[model samples]
Target: MEILQIDDTLSLKRTVDGGTEEQRKAVKAIISEVRAAGDQALRAFTEKFDAVKLDDFRVTEEEILEAYHAVSSAVVEIITEAAANIRTYHEKQLRPSWMTTAENGTMLGQKVTPLDSVGVYVPGGTAAYPSSVLMNVIPAITAGVERIVMVSPPGQDGKLPPGVLVAADIAGVKEIYKVGGAQAIAALAYGTETIKPVDKITGPGNIFVALAKREVFGDVAIDMIAGPSEIGILADDTARANEIAADLLSQAEHDPRACAVLVTTSRTLAENVLDEVYKQLPHLPRKDIATEAIENFGAIYVADDLEEAVGAINQLAPEHLEIVTENPVGLLGKIKHAGAIFLGRYSSEPVGDYFAGPNHVLPTNGTARFSSPLSVEDFQKKSSIILYSEQAMNENGAKIAEFARLEGLEAHARAVEARLK
Candidate 1:
């Protein structure tokens, strides 16, 4: 890993966001073709990109039952436990419709409604992570969304992974489609003969999938456009070098462009962690990907003090932050921006990624400064409620009409005046 002194302008912006002009154009074309051609477009694109020709797109009930049998009972138990933890955590975030009425008889409230339908994209390309299926679908289920549709690319064998299908069943996802890429996103947004349009879409994907989400966002709500995975460790001499190295490698192994950084007050510690990273790299199965991420996007910066490290972290706004210092909780107050923060040595990033109950679908590319992690709220919508008694309207309508007239809205003013009389 490269080492640098913490400067005012740290190079956290070294990586680019997903999709280029050419890629964007291609994604738009796929979306357009899918919108126009419907199921036929999905079939053609599935064969072209996934290298599998399918007579149908929906995963059968028999396939789901077979998927359960395919995986070990041990795996099912693990997923079940994780799902319970996830459900418990998100249940705390549930909100109810609320209203307030004043003595003057003005009633104001918000009605929180779950979306009617949703589409969740699960990537089955180079890797298949059942954790994502759980993270994306559970919140919608908890929100009481009526219909949940899931789409994933089929392998060359024209089959979905058993773990993925099993996890979907655990999450209560009923409609599973064997289509993927930009075309799948289009099918979800605009509706094909086989796939119905959804109110929203959520999940992580590659550049093509990310671009497709961007293009269809206005037509249908979507989760944030995720970038490459990243982890930032803010530590001191109290933290273990080897443990820090292991945590960094977890994210680095995700993609060639993934970033892993260490910010510390001890130069000795920085050097030790750097050496430890090299030591641990060779042992990982995804060593080649980790090495590329470490060589290109990874770095270790020595800060003058913890304050400087905290400031740099806020600037970077990392998707995952691990605070391993003498007092992780104390440092928490200073962190202004981050998608999810893992405290202490034991609370590693993967804990939150899999079993920790919090949503792992996080905003990336420094968007955490303004955005938040996926939560039960993402699956629900809120509408403001207003009702006034005749007495209340008699007192307020003239004022409302005057305000509307100041904005040069004559129709709005007249409507309020009519109500007043």
Candidate 2:
């Protein structure tokens, strides 16, 4: 990993944004064909990409029932604990429909209703992640989504990983499917003969899966255009180099494109953390992927001051940000754009990733500057609430009529005028 010395600002927005365009175009093309072709396209793509010849895509209720006993008690206990934490966190994020009545007789309120159905795409085959099942399903359940459907590519043996099935069931998913990749996204976007279309889709997958989600976003509501996981640490001389290095390796192991970065004011600290990262990498099972990710995108920045370190961190806008400084709470206010903020040495990134109540599915790349982590709010929609009495309408109708005429939307103004009259 190259150490970028921050004496001046360099625009990183162009670099990150420019990288996804090609993948986006290819994904958009796949979605269009799949939406138009429907069932046949899904079948063809399943064979083409997943190398599986599946005549049926829906997982049976029988399979879900059997999934319970397929896993050992130890795994079930872990999933149970994670689900409870996730459900607890998301329940707090729930906001019911609200109203404030005026002195006038007009009744008004916003109805907060969950989507009737939603799709959760769990990556299967070799890319299975049980944690993602918990992250995606718990919030949708909390938001009151009536039917939650899951899709994942099946193995040659025609079964999902027992852990993935166990996690989804624990998180309250009502259905599962044997489809994956862009076609699975397309199947969720446009219903096939077997798989029903969903109102929204949430989960993480490969670049193809990500691109497909982007293509079908408007047709079917999507959580975010997810990229590889990323983490940025803002530390000082007071921070522990070994712990900081471990945190960096954590994200790097997620994917080959994942990024782990450190920005610090102390030059010696930067060097020490880099050494620790090398030592830690050898102990991880996913060392090859983490090594590729860290060697390519991982970096350490030595800043002249804390302000400069923060300025660069903001430019990155990482999915996970940890302040491992002496007074992490003091530095809390300084961070403006991170999917989630972890403070103190013990409050590492993995706390939020697993047992902590917060959602692990978060905005990636620099999207944290504008987007947010997934929550119950993502599963629900809000409609604007407006109320006006006859008196209020009568007083304001003429002005609204005049303004509507300026925009050539007189019919809109006339509706109010007619109400007033």
Candidate 3:
């Protein structure tokens, strides 16, 4: 990992938020074509991108059942267990329709309504992320979304991954398609003859998919324009350098562009962890990818004090922040922004990525400063319901009329006056 000698305030103004400009332009073109041509364009694009032409894109009930059977019984149990945990965590987030009444008979409330339909995009690139399938689908199901449509690229055999299909089943996803890349995103945004358009789409994909979601955002709601995964480790003299090195390696393995950074007040600890990172990288399965990440984006920053470390972390706004220092709680209040904060050495990024009930789909590339991880709330809508009694209208109508007239909106003023009169 590169050591950034920090002597002044860091200015990271030009960091790429999501993906390259090429990805954005390519995805926008696909979305535009899909919007214009509809299903016919969908089929053509599917054939060209996915390398498989389909008579129908939507999965049948039989397909879901078959998918459940296709996977090992052991794998099925794992997916099922993960689903239960995810459900338990999100159940608390369910928002109920509420009403409030005034003494003068003015009542106002919001109706928490589940969306009619939603879409999920699963990546099928270098690896299949079944966890993402669960993370995206369960929340929509918990929100009582009526229909959940999913799309992922098929393998060389032109069939969806068994793990993805099984996870979808566990999460109560009803419709899935054998299409992926930007084209799949387009098909979901603008309905194809076979792939129906959905109200919203969730889940993570490659840069192309992220860009496609950004392009079709107004047409269909998306979880977030997610970027590469990242982690920030705040360690002190109390922490073990080996353990800290292991934690940084966990995030480095995600992608070459992924960031695995270490910020420490002790120069000795920082140097030890750097030495340990080299020792541990070779044994890892994705060492090649991790090595690239560590070589480029990965950093070991030596801070003058703990406060300086926190200040740098807040500025980075990493997807996962690990406070591995002494008295992690004491420093907790110092962290102003992050996608998810892992306190103490035991609380690693992997714990949250798997097993833990928290949603792993997080904001990336410093977007956490403004965005949040995916949750049940992302799938639901809120509608305000208001009822004013005649007496209440009489009490406030003159003031309302005057306020509207002050804005030079005579029609608005007359509308209230007519009701009061």
Listed in order, each prediction's TM-score against the native is 0.98, 0.92, 0.93
| lDDT for each residue of candidate 2 in 143-231, tens digit (9 for 90 to 100) | 98999999998887777888888888788777888888888898898887777899999988877887788778788899887887889
Write the residue-wise lDDT of candidate 1 on 1-421 in tens digits.
7789988778564566666889999998999898899999999999999899999999999999999999999999999999989999999999999999999989999999999999999998779889999999999999999999999999998999999999999989989999888998999999999898999999988889989998899999998889999899999999999999999999999999998999999999999999999999999999999999999889999999999999999989999999999999998999998999999989999999999899999978888999999999999999999988899989889999999999999999999789776
lDDT values for all models: 0.92, 0.85, 0.84
Candidate 3 lDDT at 381 equals: 92
Candidate achieving higher TM-score, 1 or 3: 1
Worst 10 residues of 1 by lDDT: 11-20
lDDT of 3: 0.84
Runs in model 3 deviating more than 4 A are 7-14, 17-25, 36-39, 60-70
Clash pairs of candidate 2?
none
| Per-residue lDDT of model 3, residues 216-325, tens digit only | 88978888877667888888899999999999999889888788888889999988999999999999999999998888878888999988888898988888999988
* Deviation (Å) of 118 in candidate 2: 0.7
